[model samples]
Target: MKKEFAVIGLGRFGGSICRALAEEGMEVMAIDVDEDRVNEFSMIASHAVVGDTTDESVIKSLGIRNFDHVIVAIGDNIQASILTTLILKELGVNKITVKAQNDYHEKVLRKIGADHVVHPERDMGRRIAHNISSNNVLDYLELSDEHSIVEIVANEKLSGHTLIDLDIRAKYGINIVAIKRRNDIIVSPLAHEEIQTNDILIVIGADVDIVRFEKKVMG
Candidate 1:
């Protein structure tokens, strides 16, 4: 069954998520305090309403707790975000994801029962910086402070070697989870699979080990 989602705040982050969810055929309700913002998404969302989420009665009237998930993407207004999240939790929402403006806001959101908190701008900046800093690193996803999954382009130094020949897990403490070659993706590639130039290696491991592998093996 398709999960139902409610996105409060019709800003960039919330609007993007609402559009994507609708595109995937999921039922999505878009809400915002501004009439214009709600009108803008009227055609895009399954239901678009203008309402102040911070008001408990307004939230209750929308039957928000019935949705599988709720996303609080209120921008700039930290107080409104916190109040809405608290009300959602009090009303027994299954899951709540919130966008935090800063570290303090994230801490508060977690304390108040947010299922997930994201720092989109900060995370995107880090990904862009990682891609720019190393020619080998095509993309990066932070799993935690100490660990990450990175997409690395196989250079000449690594192109001719097989997984077993490289002994990468033993040497670098990282696993090549998948190999993207041309248009194909090999998930959990075999030990005998040989890497080729330009093949994208989706590697997961500790941050330090990944950096070491990038400098030594990818060179």
Candidate 2:
């Protein structure tokens, strides 16, 4: 079954998510206070409505609680975003995802019952900084505040070692979840799987442990 989602904002982040969800064949209800933004997404979304998200009656009237997921993406206006999130929670929305502008915003969202909070701008900046900082580090994703998943090229030092020999989980508290070589991808690689020089390792672990693993193994 196609999951139903409501994106409550028409700015870049919200609009992009609405478009992507619609493109993936999901039902997306796009909401915005701006009539122009609503009109722009009418053709792209399952439904588009112009309404003030901070109003509880507006949300209830639209039956927003029925959506499988609701995203509060109101930009710039922190008060509106927080109030909307609180209203959605009170209305019993199954899942609530909020776009937080900063750490303080994220904390507030979490306190108000947002199931998930994203800092898209900050995360993008971090990715860009990581890419510019190291040629070996291809990508970085924060699974949690302390945990992360990273993609790094296998250096010469790791060429012949198998996962069992390295004992990454025991020594570094990290797991080599997968390996990507050119066009090939090996998922949940076996303990005996040997590492080839230049192969990309997709690893997951605590951020500090990942750093240690990268320095000790990939360095």
Candidate 3:
């Protein structure tokens, strides 16, 4: 069954999400206050409407509660975004995702019952900075303020060493969650599994510990 999704705001982030969802064969309702933006997406989205999302009556009339997921992507206008989210929650929308401009905005959205909040620009900037800073670090994802999941290349020092021989978990407080060699992947790799020179390790642990592991093991 195709899932139903509503994307509010026609800015870069929201527009990209709406297009991708529609391309994936999902039922998408694209909403925005700008008539031009609505016209731009009318051909791609299942439905497109130019309406003020902050108005509860406008939202209810659109039957937004019928959607399985509603993404509040209002840009610049924090008040409109917060009010729309609050109205959606009150109307019993099944799931609500919101894009927050900053930490303060995220806190407010959380307090108002946003199911998920994303800081796309901040998170993307962090990832780009990490990749540029370290050649060994291929990718980095911040799970929380203290924890992260990282993908690093196995170096000569780690090559041919099994998980038990390295004692990575005990020493660095990080777990080798998965091993990726070329196109192959081994999930929850056993202690006896050997690391190849070019293997990619997907490790999960505290941010500090991940840095420690990267320096000691792959530096």
Candidate 4:
């Protein structure tokens, strides 16, 4: 079955989610308090309406609880965001994801039963900083506060070494999950698979272990 999504807030983040969901052929309802913003998404979303989501009657009228997932993306106004999420939870929405302004906002949202909370700006900043700090780190994804998946470029130091020879999992407590060579990708690469210079290694491990592996092996 196609999952239905409702996005409350028509700012950049919410609008982007609407567009991506629409592109993926999902049914999406876009809502905003501003008529202009709602009108802008009229052709992009399955339905676009101008309404104050914080008002219980407004949300009930739209049948928002029917959506499989709801995203509270209200910008700047932390109070409104919390209120909207609370309303969604009260209405028995199955899953709710909220964009949090900061740590405090996130804590409040969690307490109010938000299924997921995201700090987009802060996360993007971290990704950019990681890329800037390391030449070998092609990309970084935070799986959690202490765990991450990183794409590291294999340098001369790591070339010709097999997984067994390096003892990656045993030594650094990290796993080389995949190897990307040219246009091809090898998932769950075997222990005997040899590393080639410039090969992109997709690794997963705790942050400390990943950092140690990068410095001792890739660096």
Candidate 5:
């Protein structure tokens, strides 16, 4: 059965999530205080309503707790965002994900029983910064403060070398989990498999070790 979702606040983050959920054939109820914002999603979401989520009565009337998931994506309004999340929790919403404005906001959301809190803007900024700094780095995913997984574009220096030949694990303490070559993805690649310059290596390891590997091999 398809899951039902209610996304409160019709800003960029919430709107994008709503559309993506709808595209996956899930039922999405889009809500916002602004009538214009609600009207805009009438065709996109299963139900679009102009209602302030801060009000407990409105929350009950909308039956938000019945949805499989609820997302609070209030824009710039920290008070409203926190209030909405608190009300959702009090109403026994199954799962709640909130978009936090900053570290302080994230802390508050966590305390209020938000199942997940996302700092999308901060994460995107880090990703973009990493991509721009290294010519071979295609993307970066931070697993923790000390570890990360990065997509590195295979350079000529790495080409024609098998995993066994490079011994990346022993030398750099990083593991190449997969290799992406255009349409093909080789997961848990064999040690004997040779790398091509066009391949994108998906590697995971300690941040320092990954940087060492990138600089020593990619350059």
Candidate 6:
């Protein structure tokens, strides 16, 4: 059986999650305080409704606690977001993910029992900055303050060298987990496999190590 998901607050973030879940064939219930927003997703989501999520009665009457996971994506309204999350936690929802506007909001959400809290705007800003700063870097995902996964484009210096020949792990302390060539992807590439220029290397390691590897090898 497909897991059930509930997304409250039909703003850009919530709408995107609902659409993505529906695209993956999951049963998604989209909720919003705005009637127009709810109507927009009526056809895309398994269910769509408009109600104030801050009211515990509204949430319980809608059977929201039964969902496998619930996401609070309320925008701008910090009080509403916090209240909704608190209500969900009290209702014994198994998992509740909340979108926080800032670090202080995230801390409060965590204290109030949000299973996960995301600062999407701040994270996106960092990713954009990284991409623009390094021409060799195609993409960046921050896993922690110290660690990240980056996609780097191979240059002429790495055109013919194999993984073993470069000794990347020993020298740079980073791992090239996969290589993307044109439309194909090579996962856990073998040591003897030679790297081709223009290949996209998906590497993971501490942030400092990844930066060193990108500068030395992909420059």
Candidate with more favorable, higher TM-score: 2 or 5: 2
- Go through the candidates in order and give each one's C-alpha lDDT: 0.96, 0.93, 0.94, 0.95, 0.95, 0.95
- Which residue pairs overlap in candidate 3's backbone? none
Model 4 compared with the native: what TM-score? Answer: 0.97
TM-scores, in order shown?
0.97, 0.95, 0.97, 0.97, 0.93, 0.94
Cα lDDT, model 3, residue 154: 91
lDDT string for model 3 (57-124, tens) is 99999999999999999999999999999999999999999999999999999999999999989999
* lDDT, candidate 5, 149-184, per-residue tens: 999999899899999999999999999999999899
Candidate 3 residue spans exceeding 4 A from truth: none
Off-target runs (Cα >4 Å) in candidate 2 are: none
Residue pairs in candidate 4 whose N, alpha carbon or C atoms collide under 3 angstroms: none
Least lDDT summed over 10 consecutive residues: which range in candidate 3?
210-219
Which is superior by TM-score, 5 or 6?
6
Question: With candidate 2 superimposed using the best TM-score fit, by how many Å does residue 79's alpha carbon deviate from the native?
Answer: 0.5
> Could you tell me which residue pairs clash in candidate 5?
none
What number of backbone clashes does candidate 4 have, counting pairs of residues 3 or more apart or in separate chains? 0
Off by over 4 Å in 5: none
